[model samples]
Target: MDETAQEKKLSAHNASPTQASDHPADPVLSGGFRFDRMELAGAFGDLGTLLPIVIAMILINNLSPSSVFFAFGLLYLLSGFVYRLPIPVQPLKAVGAIAIAYPAVVTESVIGASGILFGAFLLVVSLTGLMDWMAKLFSQAVVRGIQLTLGLVFLKKGIELIIHKDLFMSGAQNRLAEYPVNLIIGITVFALVLLLLDNRRFPAALAALVVGIGSGLALGGFSTLTLAFGPTDVRLISPSMSDYWTALVMLIIPQIPLTIGNACVGTASTCTSLFAGNPLLAKAKAGMFALTMGIVNLPAGFFGAVPMCHGTGGLAAHYRFGARTGGAPIMIGAFFILIALVLGELGFSLLALIPRSVLGVLLVFAGLELCPLLRNLKTNEEYFVALLIAGIALAVPNMGWAFAIGIAVDFFIRKMNVRI
Candidate 1:
């Protein structure tokens, strides 16, 4: 929506609180859209979270790279055109993680089928306004808890990559295996990003990628890459009853709460906070977020693509690195489409050139950007719930369980009329 139209909608509502104090003041919306160096640079913000899972799924599960990249490209374009904001679109993290870790169980048919059923479920919930009521159950503290939980999850994943703890998940073989090149490269890029994080003249993400790519080429990354041309293969899948059952039990059950808490609620709240000055932007609802995820995943599921959703961390990464408008995602969308065309099934191996450590740094920084969200949790009771959620999520290694425990405690406190 344009500024004038958004301004009108906000005024017609007949309400505007003193100021939306939900999250920290991130004034990106004030600039509208731009297609400059910074937007180009910021376009790569979420690749850290995006690339590894994509690579793993394609390499491990024999997924159609063309379909996956095409789905991502289309989804990115849809979000750009519809919301006209740099709203993040990411693979369903838990689903992708589980599939990568256990490719034997999460076969291509199972992954595709999971998308079909899960998308339908979210569509029902979103269209019926069920998520709206469910969202009200989430307090600011709970949202913060979700944010912290996902951030920590991203942090832990990045650390694991840097140290090469379980390297097979990403299909990334340590190219410079003799020594800890990933660790060294990770530290170098991490430092470079920190030094230039706020420098508009030289965006952090852009600088980091340049360094990482250079390091990768120096370490014999180019030898592994193969170039292909022409259209990428894409076809629909016919999932069996067993595929659906596996998807339901292993993928959907564990992923639902994270999708609800982080993807819908966490993302919408982060959008409102970052774009707080605009009531239209603030009006970006959890239902709308869910609807988009459902809409995209419907096709993504049919075509053997990994399920996708929004994330607070991706938004923070984009905005912090200087993506002011939908242009950032458009740039990325087009990039992916081009890659799918040129690289075809070889789309993933090209990225294997960059050190895993560099990818880890991107994830770490994205998580750090989410720290600003926790600043608004003022009271001790709020802190208790949020921190407890964070602790449980990391310890249990499950966002679904953490969200359940957090909301239960939130309701209990409210009913008791007591502070922690």
Candidate 2:
């Protein structure tokens, strides 16, 4: 080779390492901690996305801190090990918060990572190309039905927050203010979100969540700054094998749909709509991850833990933060592990700093994400099936049966050839 050509080759070889160093191949396991643009965006944007979810799990699920820790530990382990997705995983804190709000009202012990496990399974199935076949099993009507049902359910939940301002009290505070605060926060954030969503001028979701949360804090809305933060002395919970069985039954039956139907599907659709330029993967991924979550929950339930799942709230945050791959989840998982170890009264205290009203705002905005499904009602059979699913889901209070009803409806529709 000529000297000029050899020099060019040498320069190219030397430059490769620098180019490689500019970005890690994967965000989850990379050791150097060089923040990816998506990671930073997701980190900041997801905070609000995560807030209402975490709050809901705590209030609705009625889980203890120990249970929370165990769930996170399991989530961390599975996200890194079993699913093998490029995504980072964390305990669904929103699951915990939602559990707390509903308080075994819908599913028992909502603090665990069961939903997330399910989502992971669904994701795997999608990746493996099983989703299309699965999708064929149900009609577009059934799928849209499920989406509409979940949207309505979440909408009710948002309204319930508004309705129950008198109930969520702390110390001497009425917390009634939380209702209006939530309304204001939610409206403001949502409006901003819609605008930024169109332009991408800023990290819209994260900004909305931050503005809402920060406004709450600045206005004496909530404050965790005084709370403790360090290594927490967490006690691992050990429940009997029976408790596991009970938890398994509770999670596997009633709440499975929440994972498969709502969370997994919702997330996949959002991603497809936003990033990958296709919604087919969303359908497949949701089911794949749902199955994975089932496997994770089966064993973890025996350890006195609650189940976990992704929330639209968190996914919205993930999307807002610009998370392209699974790396956002991986980062979230690390956060869970750290909180499990270091959060105690301090952590709870920090959580306390978030006004219940502010959290309500988060939930309200989250519910709005489901609004796109309102278009489903424009169709006849779809509207009928969707309302039926929503009614069943809202009434039965068991997620399993609710999903079963929807799927069962699918069978009936197919048998009749009604074209629903």
Candidate 3:
């Protein structure tokens, strides 16, 4: 066989159970996992989602970086093993954003209780199969709309990060006043990423990280490397009655809708779209998605670790940068574990070395990857529904609301027998 024929054979053989057989499996399945430099780079492709929230929680909420890193690392490894794909574990953005924005109002106990309560809720939903029902409620139009909105959000954030001086040091500077040197560096990195995107032998994300590190070092971003071996003081925490109450009313209530819309429905749709030929891919049902979040956050909550979830954006980011197997998460997970162990207290200082521009470029491309999914909408009616949902999602900046709106619009259109 020629190289192309051989590649086709490998792909067909690796198709998930759903694609391979008429009947799909009940539980989530995985494709074969491979560990390589490409997978390693794919692991870090979603840093834009992980780092910002983590940094904020640590700085604003006084959360322990060691505990957060450890939880994230351990969970990522487990997710890869369980899903057998590049399923990403990411910080719960709604909770993280709320906590960061209102640190004075949101207490640590509240955060911990939120995670515990949310985890339990998800666990029950998954076990009872309620998540499967919920997943079915979202139409393809709604899912596509959510994906587009998320892609745009990431893209906008990426552009912001790229133009800024540095995430930590920059205050309010001119939008166009970035140092000429930094602009040059950003342009160079962006160009390199675009050029190497299709080059399997040289993963673009890996190349970007290498260039970013080199540039950061040369620019004195890491003038001193402080490696510490001090023991971390993370312990299991039990939430109080008040903490649970606070979490239920404040955090859990707002987060549930978002989680159901994005983490469950959005992620499952993305997986199926990407791996259509694999029957096992269909096993990435809403219940399984919920189970992963519940398993990760329940224990992590006790230790004040940042709660995590599987996100469509993170999945797209990983797959966009050449991550095709379970090995990608495992590789990245091990790196996080190493960071947690070696730099228990000094984690923030080390992360500070990464340049904002490089991360921006990565986010930009990851967002770009998601845009192609919009093409899946075949009808003008589908496009109209999708555009409506996308508009609502972007305008209100609430994915849950947008999801509901999209579904309602789609239903109404179908009911009216509207033809475009």
Candidate 4:
């Protein structure tokens, strides 16, 4: 079939009522709110993406856990209500990676400023409808390429997490070599995930978490567990002019292309793919996405919240498990709020006890969930462009550069009528 015909067929399939109502439960009739086992399991589907950054910011940058949790919880709660879907609020990966890798160079103030500046930028673009305009510029091939690249990225990270021991754990002894305990755990969880992928009665993520926590406790990973309740100290962060400038140049500038490509365009595309028949869930435009970022980050920046975004990966992770409505984020948000208000520092300790192998299994499956989009490529040229973008993205370790190069190559090929 021709590209146009293929596109039409896919659209038709997505718009079918059967596809829309394929979830284990009808979200619309359920009042779009569910706190069942599947929803709770879906809540942790993106923990592999969330916890590392939160822990890094707290441990390395000395950011207050309570404040961060509060911001995270608050945003998750707001996003669920506003989007009325399983749409997630995730830490911006670009900013998190840079901040975590170079803690000395990227201070808390710098991170805070990056959030504020980026928030303002998104707000302006969203208000001006520039986001919508930009979103239209990318072809389906480009979007698919971005998804493929991200899937591979997640796969790489998941493997790393599985093979390596926890950073907090002592003894440089390799977990894979010592007794292959982590490897065994990873395989077991992976098999379990596969087995339960389609079983609504059994939530794979929740089961994985249970196994992970159980294994951690057996290994004496959590020596002590304490719960403390107190007023979280949330202080206003006022970045100086220099700090703002530095963040704009160093952090925000580098992140803009990624924000545009993955957070906005890719996310919107994935929503359409996943919820093809459900107009309300599928029609996430770039402007709406940017607005969410602006709304969440504005407060997050001022209060030292981890800068956040709604990315395609997070959405896929949530859907891969069992989340079918806004209830997932609401449930997770409430959990975070409780942690922030009651557990505070102790929350980190509990998170630390979750075996890295289990988290790795989750990441692996999340990555796998995103791989289906690649099957949409119709032509050899399209496949070439997508593969090129994925290769470049992995090699350069930058999605923005990959996107730019892919677009240029695609344009050149089309203009020249080059049949590769």
Against the true structure, candidate 4 reaches a TM-score of: 0.90
Model 4 alpha-carbon miss at residue 48, Å:
1.2
Segments in model 1 whose C-alpha atoms lie over 4 Å from true places:
1-32, 165-175
Decide which is better by TM-score, 3 or 4.
4
Q: Residue-wise lDDT of candidate 2 within 1-420, one digit each (tens)?
A: 011333233323322222222444532223223245444445444343344454445444544544455465556445434332223233443244434544544343222334434444555665676654554444444555555555565556655653444322232243454545545655665567666653434755456545644654565534334355654443344444453454345444445445555556544443333323222233225555555555665555444345555444455444433544444455656665566567654555454454444344444544554445335334576666767776776786565465667777767775797764
Residue-wise C-alpha lDDT for candidate 1, range 302-400, written one tens digit per residue: 889988888888887777676756888888888888777676745555665666777888889888767656766668888899999999988885679
Residue 139 error, candidate 1, Å: 0.8
What TM-scores do the predictions have? 0.89, 0.64, 0.87, 0.90
* Model 2 spans with C-alpha error above 4 angstroms: 1-137, 159-187, 190-195, 198-201, 218-226, 245-252, 263-287, 294-305, 311-317, 320-322, 373-383, 394-396
In angstroms, what RMSD does candidate 3 have relative to the true structure? 5.7
Worst 10 residues of 4 by lDDT: 167-176
* Tens-digit lDDT track of model 4 for 1-420: 013444445545533242235543566334467677777888889987787677777778767777788878888898788776778778888888888888897888888898899899999999999998888766788888988988888888888878764422322233344476777788888999899876678889988988887877676665544455553567788999988988887788788888888888888887777665454644477788899889878868887778888888888898788776788999998888888888875675677677677878888888887877788787889899989999999999567899999888988888899897
